[model samples]
Target: MRAVSLVPSLTEAIARSAPGAVAGATDWCTHPPDLDVVRVGGTKNPDTGRILSLAPDLVIANEEENRAPDLEALREAGAEVLVTEVRDVPQAFRELDRVLDACGVPSHPRWLDEAEDVWSSLPPPATRRTAVVPVWRRPWMVLGRDTFAGDVLARLGVGHVYATHPDRYPRIPLEELRAAAPDVVVLPDEPYRFTADDGPEAFRGLPCALVSGRHLTWYGPSLAEAPRVLGRALRAARP
Candidate 1:
């Protein structure tokens, strides 16, 4: 069966379910690295025409990634869409199970068990330090409480300094970031593309870590490696 995954998280899930069966993926889809999947624009502005042309039997979407109007259009076009909302780790695992069930693929319980084992093996997070994860540019939005990144940070033994903010990705003033004095500012590679070279000038004076956004924030089987890489970065960035 052919499928199109608009969300990055679901893209990974779809890939894990049936590696080469995913005929289309969003521009943000990077996991499973080099599968010959079709690029159908992005999660926000999916090329509906191009996707329809693929004649997919199933379409995977997410509340965070797929736009409302676009999703409506797809529904009107008679496509069977499976929309998933993954706010935390439990939801993420459930979504993976859903994908495998929908695709009629056997669930990889052993693999998932191993992934959970890895997560459980990690040490408790460093309670003293706080970290901010920037996921956008220009206005400079950061991951707040109630996001996948926040949960991942908690698992890695780090604290979300911006968790008190109401929004998941609120744009904070430079002065606030400076005043907050986070022990480590993690600049993720995608969704915002911040690198070490483009350090926050106000906080460049402080310690920082240039981290792989996927490993630190992404939820899926990839989460298996998160604690190790994130723990290393957090420890090394300590003053």
Candidate 2:
């Protein structure tokens, strides 16, 4: 079964599980580094014509990562599109099973089991830390209420300052974020690519944890490593 994936995590999941089943993927689908698939474009603005040209039996997409118009266009063009909505770890696991099964994967992938094991084995955080997680800079968008990343952090004892906000990804001024005075400033390296030299300066006196965005945000094989990778980073953060 030939598949084209618009979501990066789904692309990696499908590619790793079913091998040659994935015939195309978005340009941002970077995992499985040696993936040899046709580049369909980016998540928000995928090339509909290019995707249709691939002649895939299934197209995998995410509710958050993909645009509705693009998915509709694909369906209009006679492609079977499977859209996934993963708002938390358990949802991610369920969606993984759904997508892989739809793609005709013979058995459960080892990584999926490992991811579940990793999260389930973790003990509750001894001390909860209030954190301001910045997903982008410039205009400063943060992880707000009902975000998958916020839920992931909450499971690890890190709570977002804006978790009660209405927007999923709210853009607020940097000064406003600092005024919240979080226990730690968590910075992920995607969407904004915040590095030690870049993001820390914005939260001078606050403890800053530079984290892997893939581990924190992407739901795939990275889930198995997220607990360890994010835990170490969060532990090392000091004011």
Candidate 3:
């Protein structure tokens, strides 16, 4: 089955599970760096015309990572697109299995099984901390309300202060963020490349953990190692 994965994590999972099943992928789907496929553009703004040209049997996308109009456009063009929504760990696993199966994977792949095992077997958190997780700078958009990332962090004993906010991703003034005074400031490497030197300085007193965006955000194979990796980062940032 020729599939076009619009999400980076899905692309990686598909590529790893089935050698050459993906016929097209977004430019940002860079996991298997050597994955040679037709570049379909970015997740938010994929080139529907180019995508349709490949004549993919299936197109995989995420509710959050992809735009509705683009997916609809693909559907209008006669491409069968499977959009997956992953609001939490359980949802992510279920969607992954469904997506893989739809892409012709006869059964659950080893990586997927390992990923499930890791999350299911995680021990109690060593410590819990309240954090202000920032995804972007400039205007300072943060993880708020019911987000997959928030659920992931909750599982790891780190809770973001904005989880109760009205908006999923609210643009708050930097001053307001500093005023919140969370125990730690969790910064991810994607959406905005927050490095140790770049994002930490803004939160002077708050311990900042620069975590891998793929582990913290993406909901595919990375989920297997996300617990350990993100847990270590959160632990290290404890003040």
Local distance difference test, each candidate: 0.77, 0.92, 0.91
Highest-scoring model, lDDT = 2
Error of 3 at 210 (Å): 0.3
Q: Tens-digit lDDT track for model 3 on 189-208?
A: 99899997888888888888
Report the Cα lDDT for residue 29, model 3.
92
User: How do the residues 179-238 of candidate 2 rate in per-residue lDDT, one tens digit apiece?
Assistant: 999999999999789998999998989999999999999998899999999999999996
Root-mean-square deviation of every model = 1.9, 0.9, 1.1
By TM-score, is 1 or 2 better? Answer: 2
TM-score of candidate 1 to 2 decimals: 0.92
In model 2, which residue pairs have backbone atoms overlapping below 3 Å?
none
Q: Where does model 2 exceed 4 Å of error?
A: none
How big is the positional error of residue 223 in model 2, measured in Å on the Cα after superposition? 0.6
What TM-scores do the predictions have?
0.92, 0.98, 0.97
| Best by the TM-score measure | 2
What alpha-carbon RMSD in Å does predicted model 3 have with respect to the real structure? 1.1
Model 2 scores a TM of 0.98
User: Candidate 1: how many backbone clashes?
Assistant: 2
